[model samples]
Target: MVANLDASSKAGSVLIVGAGIGGMGSAQLLAQMGYKVYLLDSAPGIGGSMHLLDRTFPTDSCGICIMSPDQPSYCPTLECGMHPNIEILSYAEVESLEGEAGDFRALVKHRPRYVDIIGCNNCGLCVEVCPVERPDDHEGRLHEVKAIYRPPTRAVPDTYVIDMDYCTRCGKCVEVCPTEAIDLGMAARRSEIEVGAVILSPGYRAFDARIKGEFGYGYYDNVLTSIEFERMVSLTGSTQAHLVRPSDGAAPRRVAFIQCVGSRD
Candidate 1:
């Protein structure tokens, strides 16, 4: 059941899972109306599908301009970093849930950022010093992310995150940062909260392009998925909105669009 969008009663808080567009919209509207809202997400950042895009379709609106710096399109969990009513739980997952419909207790585990999200200034300095670069899923193979970096250009909480999986503990980012926000040995934290209602807004996944082997997907650099093409065409996208062939970095003259590669089977 959809709760009151603007109900301003601290009697029962709303717990929202998945800080996608839907989750953010719900949280925004609810908080605007005076409701005590708790936005939760397993990912380190928010904005979900929107974060990966360089621009929105049809109008080509700048996605970065559409989001608030206070409440980043990325890192929805930290939305409350600026708000007094909202609490953002970043790098955290719900470990346990109990109680009846109106009242529930949720155990959450917040993974370490290694770097302090609050102190880091979101400067690209550390990013430049870090030698390791990884495939940015947001950029669709177009851009590379540093070992310690934000999800995107204007990430919320203006903090740095340690790509724990790839971090070699080189300490270069920590050494170069002017803020000294890098904490190499931070550990995961756990906490619990009570809420009156829970909202589920799990977003849809992009259709995988690999299933259509006929397109020469990974084998052919020229071939790309619709989403990848969209990213290529986006300004905020990894290519910074430059469209080019993956193999030769040359513009394409003849492009083909195949609609139902994985769906409608």
Candidate 2:
């Protein structure tokens, strides 16, 4: 897939790893200036850690509202969404690299889309019809998601993907899809690309709040990280952004925001 694109792009090819906020910004600037940019990431899509958090602090404003909506949104959280010129490869990875600056060969590994991107209308009927439901990783397992789902309402490219691991091969998504977009037989693909420069922007990882045993992060339902708390506060979130204890389903009156759990070191 990458090779097909590599051959099409003109001079000044740029390979960008980690399609986070920085990567998207850089790709747009370069593409607008007449550069053929190749953006890749190991995750299913871009948005990086930005999608995990609910909103920015201090003002308590919704991150999605403040961010630009013109670009493709990775999830419903408005702050992280769209960009026109960026070629996004979610569920992709880089296998190898060769050559040098001004011309480097990159081997890219692409996972199957499972659901057809072109035909599907994003009506979410497949999700409603499918029987299998799994942990919603976007919500940090706080809720369950259908086998097929859009990353969020704001997701760009406006497509839904199938969860091969959880999909029961029931063909429900395919049957319900008005556009015949579901294709369960797609396989992983590999391709190569040649680029002049590679910009790596692999972002940061969230510290496991479970490490601090005192808070009982994994054991108790009330305790959560900043990101989890943010989702709990979001009306679009799994819980409809309600701040309640998962164990009891009651709203929490006394909440503690613990800073520097891991960063103090």
Candidate 3:
């Protein structure tokens, strides 16, 4: 929920360098205490690592993994990105940070999605018309999603983005957008904003098992990372929400995961 747009930032605003769980949760807490927050992430949607994982820990519960459902709690999950005080800047990378502790300016490079965030309503028509397909990174590349797509149906911001790098500029999506939100010519925009404080949580990447070679990560299709395995078992994962082996696309009777493979963690 958003506070008044004109609620007034008496305490000044804070620029959060990442919209992951850490940055978003801090934004929500600070916002509740009366401070404007600019939440930024380099991805097309919020949730960061939370977005890729199919389920939460312990029992694979998805309760708070997706978007927060307007609840009342102090949960420090990435769901706080939906708060009104947090102005999410997805697909934005922070270029530089200037100034001292309390007064800082962040220079952000915003890559264009070619779709107007304000006008688009997350309709799947553009996806239906687009002929290009790519490995779904959100599903840990275990499956495919449209080149023009949203990371997840329940993803925050609820908007679609075009992977311009992989997109063929087919213009088919441009023609099919119902809200006229698709713009094939959108350019990268640079923005600078001032804030009282900065919180950096650029997020983390899973260890590349391919480099280790012992795990046969890239060599063996059957072997997968936790994130990839998560996608295989996730209710929202790419395998029609069911578990399946990647190599043969078969259901394995027994699954085994070695703890801290190639690491001390």
The segments of candidate 2 whose C-alpha lies over 4 angstroms from its true place after superposition are 1-11, 57-85
TM-score of each: 0.86, 0.84, 0.86
The TM-score, computed over Cα atoms with residue i paired to residue i, of candidate 2 is: 0.84
Candidate 3 minimal-lDDT segment of 10 residues: 1-10
The top-ranked prediction according to lDDT is 3
Question: Mind giving the per-residue lDDT tens digits that candidate 1 earns over 1-265?
Answer: 3344335443368888887767777787667666777878776766677666666556665554355443435444345445566677767788888876666788888899888877877777888888888877666665678777776544444467878888888888878889888889899999988777788887888776777788788778788888788778876676767788888888888889878788864
Candidate scoring better on TM-score of 1 and 2? 1
Residue 165 lDDT, candidate 3, scale 0-100: 68
The residue pairs in collision within model 3 are 2-84
Going through the candidates in the order shown, the clash numbers are 8, 11, 1
- Candidate 2, overall lDDT? 0.70
Instruction: List lDDT for all candidates, in order.
Output: 0.72, 0.70, 0.74
lDDT of 3 by residue, 158-196 (tens): 688888768998799888778899998899999998776
Error of 3 at 225 (Å): 1.0
